[model samples]
Target: MSAVLISVAELQELLDTAGSRVRLLDVRWLLGDPDGPQHYLDGHIPGAVFVDLETELADPPSAAKGRHPLPDLAHLQKCARSWGVSDGDTVVAYDANGGMAAARAWWLLRWGGVADVRILDGGLPAWEKAGGKIVSGEEPDPEPGTVVLTPGHMPTVDADGAGGWQGLLLDARAGERYRGEVEPIDPRAGHIPGAVSAPTAENLTDTGHFKPIEELRARFAGLGSGPVAVYCGSGVTAAHQIAALATVGIDATLYPGSWSQWSNDPKRPAATGTEPA
Candidate 1:
């Protein structure tokens, strides 16, 4: 619903200028990592607030709703407020693992009706490479935000919608997972029927920055002609897939329940191997 990414230099400029009112969020998370907050405390962009993706950004894990189900709207609003986000604030989110985890914050803010939010392109390493400063310990409590939030600013597809999707339904997990060769967390192996493997890792370059816009366009070209939707193991990296698509001016719907929820169901048939079922 908003611009997908911001350069480290651009973000620095904003932070340097007086009254930029930039609300920086460090969404430090990895699939199996429980040390996100510890990582943030060890070193982070000065004044950047830490947001726990597993708690603040998502509802409790459930077999029916998925591991990282979208949090309740009111709770999300409270979380954003605690992050010191005021109305009209420019929010920048980042993480060490590319923008893989950071994109979750980027997507949630945009979906929460905040118009000016973006992922820090290339994430933490990008800023460090540019000689950006880092600080240890928690930041001072910012003035609590007065921002209000509404939902549905972004498009989504539920399990039924994903199954009946008319256009591309991309499985954004690793190719091996998509092929049913390996599923690390979910209950099942393989992808939803009619889904295509489009691993989120390919969306980035070796340095973890998003690939060039034209490259992204070429990567997704000819996959489908109608609307587009994406889902990952849970729903976390799916937002990264959407962010990559946004760079190429493509809008994508998210299946928040994603494979985690889909696989939990006994009735939803799954497809395996290299081809769409």
Candidate 2:
């Protein structure tokens, strides 16, 4: 199977037998908070290693970049190996915020050519609610290995590329952010001209679980032609959009730099107001 998602029950069943072959990652993170590691130390899924989204998964912030810039490929590969993930391992990632953080790691693994990966449905809360096992302690020593970087699988596009391509530029930020009405996170508030606002939250239900695959397909029906290009503030929440697209068999490329990168460049045109420019 191609990284088939396993529920809490399924994960429990596979725990002992698949210990070595299955790599469980806790990708819980908060946007501007620094207590993720402390929370993980309090408790996490048994045998799961914690992966910090900012320090481990993304590069340092730059003046012209989003808060969570894409990490170096080699560095990511090293982090993968630390969690006991190999090319052949079945990696599963999860986070507290539904699948937002987890999906980012999932997408990154696929981008790195580690195709056998999946997100824990509903994340840690779901697992805990389902009476899954938990462990409290620090992480064990990782068996590190070199990861081969394959950039081809990780498709990305800039504002110019998004404009030129026939594919849909799906903005996954909130309606307010997309409309450039209230600028809270980034210095500028607005979206790329001609991009459609398809908020990532639309893909989830009131309980934080993802919507049904059929519903997702219906929602994104006339967005565009060819592959969709998913973007959001700094490309984090955008992964949730890609996950939704993938659930419905729609393969979309990610603009990793996303709005943070686009807005920083004065040369790039940003569209404000409700209408898609």
Model number with the top TM-score? 1
- For 1-277, candidate 1 gives per-residue lDDT tens digits of 2267889888888888934589999998997789999999999999899999999999999998999999999999999999999898999999999899999988998999999889998899999999999999989988899899999999999999999999999999999999999888999999999998999999999999999888889999957667899999988999999999998889999999999999999999999999989
Q: How accurate locally is residue 123 in candidate 2, as Cα lDDT from 0 to 100?
A: 84
Model 1 spans > 4 angstroms off: 18-20
Q: Which ten residues in a row have the lowest lDDT in candidate 1?
A: 1-10
Global lDDT of each candidate: 0.92, 0.81
Which digits, one per residue and each the tens of the lDDT, describe model 2 over residues 181-209? 88787778898888899988888877677
Please give the distance, in angstroms, between residue 266's alpha carbon in candidate 2 and its true position after superposition: 0.8
Show pairs that collide, candidate 2. none
Q: How far off is residue 74 in model 1, in Å?
A: 0.5
How many residue pairs clash per model?
0, 0
Q: Where does candidate 2 have its weakest 10-residue lDDT segment?
A: 1-10
TM-scores, one per candidate: 0.98, 0.94
Question: Model 1, 145: alpha-carbon shift in Å?
Answer: 0.4
Which parts of model 2 have CA positions greater than 4 angstroms off? 1-4, 145-147, 222-224
